[model samples]
Target chain A: MNTPGHGQEERTGLGTFADNLRKVPRRFIESMFRTGRPDSDRSRNDFVFSNFFLHVQSVRTHRWSLRWSTTWGLGMVALSSFLIATVTGILLMFYYKPYPEAAYQSIKDIHFVVPTGRFLRNIHRWSANVMVFSVLIHMARVFYTASYRKPREFNWATGMFLLVVTLGLSFTGYLLPWDQLAYWAITIGANIAQSPREVTDPIGLTPHFDPGGLQKLLLLGSDEVGAEALIRFYLLHVMILPIALCGLLGIHFWRIRKDGGLAKPEDADRRLGGPDPEAVPAWTAAPRKTWSLAAVVRGRTPAVGAGAENTVPSMPHLFYAEAAVFMLTFLVCVLLSIVSDAPLKELANPNVPENPAKAPWYFLGLQELVAHSAFAGGVLIPGIIIVGLGLIPYLDREKKGTGEWFGGPGGGKLVAWSAVFGLGTVLALEAIAIRFGWLRQWFPGTPQLLITAINPGTVLTLIYGLYSVYIVRRFNSMRAGALGLFTCFLMGFLVLTVIGTWFRGPNWDFYWSPSQWPGH
Target chain B: MSTHSEPSPGKPSRLDPEAMPRRDFLGIAAASMAAGACGFAALGAAKLPKAAVLPSAAKKFKVTLPESLPSGTPFFPEGRSVVVFKDGDRVFAMSTVCTHLGCIVKPAAMGFDCPCHGSQFAPDGTVLRGPAPKGLPWLSVRSAGGGAILIDEGTVVPPGTKETV
Candidate 1:
């Protein structure tokens, strides 16, 4: 084990055989790994290129990407979180049972009986939450940077799908514990999904003799969340969503290579007019050939004019970035696990329902919206958000601010304005509905369709739409308008979620302060 | 390769960019603070004997309410501390324990109030807001003879019962 100062520096003659042990690994690394030379660029590139596991990363990466703020290392952290989740989830599965009767008891045993099972469950729970959080943050980074430009549109769309898949994973996993908290959370989610009836009722629209029931049917596998729903969620959480997410995540990562590495600033130039592709001169001087190629054989395919400054090989630099993020996530999860517990309430009893039945925190925003109208927050808005986000790369196709955040000069200002407008609108609508409730109260004879359509939720949405259209026309840039509107939407989500998580009391009624809650 | 790409995606690319002080400083600071807080909390928890965390609070609460609770009005017994709603034949009893932070709720005009977080409770044990997951729980109440309404606060029973007059 001797390696100079490291271990057993001087070995006696009989033990000399073991003294040179470090040499065996060094030789193996040189021969097999090719990274024994380490610091040299060639060795670094060879290390990534030769290794099957890391071959997906580029041999070299732009130094700009290494900055933590650029992507916040979210993509790497999310991947690490997912891996941590998978390992812990597997550990939990060994002790958990899918059946309703056994599920709650099993979770109890994991907390109390199994060795370190609580820690494993806590890691799984927190890591799952963190993965979803990081994925959303990653998307926001991509959106703000306008990285989803033209050719990258497909990747952006796939990323949007991945986000939905990530949400699905969380929602499905919510039911496994089978406590009152888990059971009702899923029940509320399932009910919310089924709420197309509320949306359809507004327009006197029948979903082709009720296609509205389809979503509920698909999610619940029955009329209500019960044994069937539990099994269905378990299957999807354990089997379907992970497999789907993994495959799509693979595509999402691979497309980065295809679409070109992380979006660079100059990508903006590619959108608008740029330094004209070095004037191509006709090869009239090529004397002999009928068919001739006068191409200036580029200096290294991807490099051509790519100057070498911040470019570092991904072998160690990026690999280390991924490793660092993973360790950080692990340490944080451990610390959190040690201090807090994943919550569990009484065993699920269908007979006894939670008064202010709620969904998971992530879906609580929609639940808050649902308190006003099941369709708008749960059905329509969420649907539009998913579809709209997917189409964003294609919608605001301006090359000018292709890779720039916010969009242009006043981009940041637009974001603030949009966020304020969005938040103010939600709060104002809630306040108005609470104060007057004119549609539901004063006008009893009015058709529910009219009432639901013009209700506070719908009205505010329309107002925001009009405001954003005005923003677009005023700004003269489609990208600027998109930035404003998207920022507003993000802020609105936080507002609604905060209300749902904290301020709303039983029956989903608004409370101005947490102290005002009727939970005496 | 190309030292120029865009302007480093969103930010202005500059000399000594990765060292662009604020972001890294904030990130490291936040991470350490969170880790430190968690470590402190864990250490605090470990230092305490298990009983300190889960105090053996007297869970059983037996309250005797006056025979008549003005119909539809919330009545707090003078000596006993449970809130009972006795409307006509129906009688429901609720503990004043704020499920959120364990603050005792005092009877208010319309409902109950926990001064600690301003969590409001309806005449029935519904949570209005400060912050907790669920509403106030209803404890079991059955009529005992001789104007004595026996209330058991240990068992959690569902509300909406019809106490036939």
Candidate 2:
């Protein structure tokens, strides 16, 4: 209360001294936080409003936005995983050396000598893996929910950049151990990065400069993975990528605020059909209690329609939930660290290359693409996917069904058809490629560019193009088209990753079972 | 939150207060509990487990290549789980034991193969395929007295005793 200065008039000298003594700690705390006492509601609000860390959060958030069902806390989990990875990565860095000669030994020493060293390293490894997984799921959720509409399009683009940065970080870290897995995986990746040359090098298509080869050179610092490559990758993994991710993440969250927080169904409805004349702003007339957003999202959705705006302060609820999730993630990481060991091989020997060398798992999809035609599979497809993801907001500009799964109307059926069609096409192409080995065998002397373009890539392009056109025509909506294309991309990626990781055995040949791999 | 009255021209004076909302009290209580929990967690984390130490003896070994070994052939010592490769004129000794779980790998079609896991090594001791995190060790191979190859398992040293043909 504002009664503090006047209340001193009634106190005796001794009572005044006691009161003043109590004020000492209060004054100190106030000096530190630059805020009021938290006993009263006014002071409690001030406490959050004045605090630097808490002030980044919105003063209040809509009730529907808080539903665990809606988001599954994926974004938070991804950020949490990043935090764990950063901390554990730093701890592991104490012992890690980024030279080909020393890296593997250093890793071995970490596992054998440093007592919680292996645990910390394992956490870092898992955190990187899970962060990528969580981000993929988060992107799927955002895409399907149609959260990237209108003003949020750029934010979605920022999210795309964040995903790329995440992949970059995961990849650069792969080479820090400098073991066989690290060496060959990165070798294959570097080769894939140069895949565009598969097209440009032949047929006199060379421009003034070669950017693809330049990129590969920059990444490797040479023609191959050696000391220069090791250092370059280490710098990228430890320094550049993390900084980029952090900066992009800041932009991403800030854009969420600028774009009016997370997407909601009613937002889509209102924006799409113009505002309802009868609908009133709910927050201005308060003391009218209703269900929180978290409640209805957990299966207590409003009976009649979307209810009054359910905005709640971030002082406790938002902060608590975030903190709890972070703690839970860290605890889970610790348990996983205790149970598992990160793989570390013997010293790197450049003379001997892994016959079926592969890239890090996340890049396996691209690797699978490169296996067919370096340019089409690696350079062209992946580049298209990344560019396509970035351009989605501009491409799908319709405001209808912006925040509902696959556009919320006849969306379920559209999604089913799209999935079936997309999956079937991808599997069929793969089946043909496996059965005939057309790309490998049929193209005896033809240039790689023509063969790559004709076989499989052409099939993929035709199927996808037809499927997208069908989606738009059948559903008579742009949202349906967007949903279909996205489903195809995601489903294709998953299929390729599965095949590359499990089915392909020795000499990059397809095997039905991993156990069937003919290894020495 | 911006609704604090300033003793304005309204009927109620500063003394007549309205009822407090449940969320305000809940916020204060939750904040305090969170603070206490953080404090305890910090105190607990202050004492980490003891740092681990590496055993010095198992860290290093010395192996001399044998004269009987041919070029590109791995020489397996009678009792030691180590293979020394004599490539042309150069000598490289590698541990036959899988780096993964320490299981001894036999020569397979690729190079060296782990039976426990599907880790395959090339002839020169690098991973051809892996569940293995690393390649086979390229132990220091130097010319030694009477052409005998001395082998070390865990760590590498410059081959003081290299085999001379």
i-RMS, every candidate? 15.5, 14.0
Model 2 TM-score, 2 decimals: 0.68
Instruction: Report the lDDT tens digits of candidate 1 across residue range B48-83.
Output: 422222222344544554555477777765544467
DockQ of 2: 0.02
User: RMSD of candidate 1 to the true fold?
Assistant: 18.8
TM-score for the first chain of model 1?
Answer: 0.84
Cα lDDT tens digits, model 2, A335-425, are 8787888888767655445556667777787666665565676667777778978887887777677667777445878778778887888
Q: Listing candidates in order, what is each one's chain A TM-score?
A: 0.84, 0.86
Q: Against the hidden true structure, what lDDT does model 2 obtain? A: 0.70
* TM-scores, all models, native as reference: 0.67, 0.68
DockQ values, each candidate = 0.02, 0.02
Cα lDDT over the full model 1:
0.69
Docking class of 1: incorrect
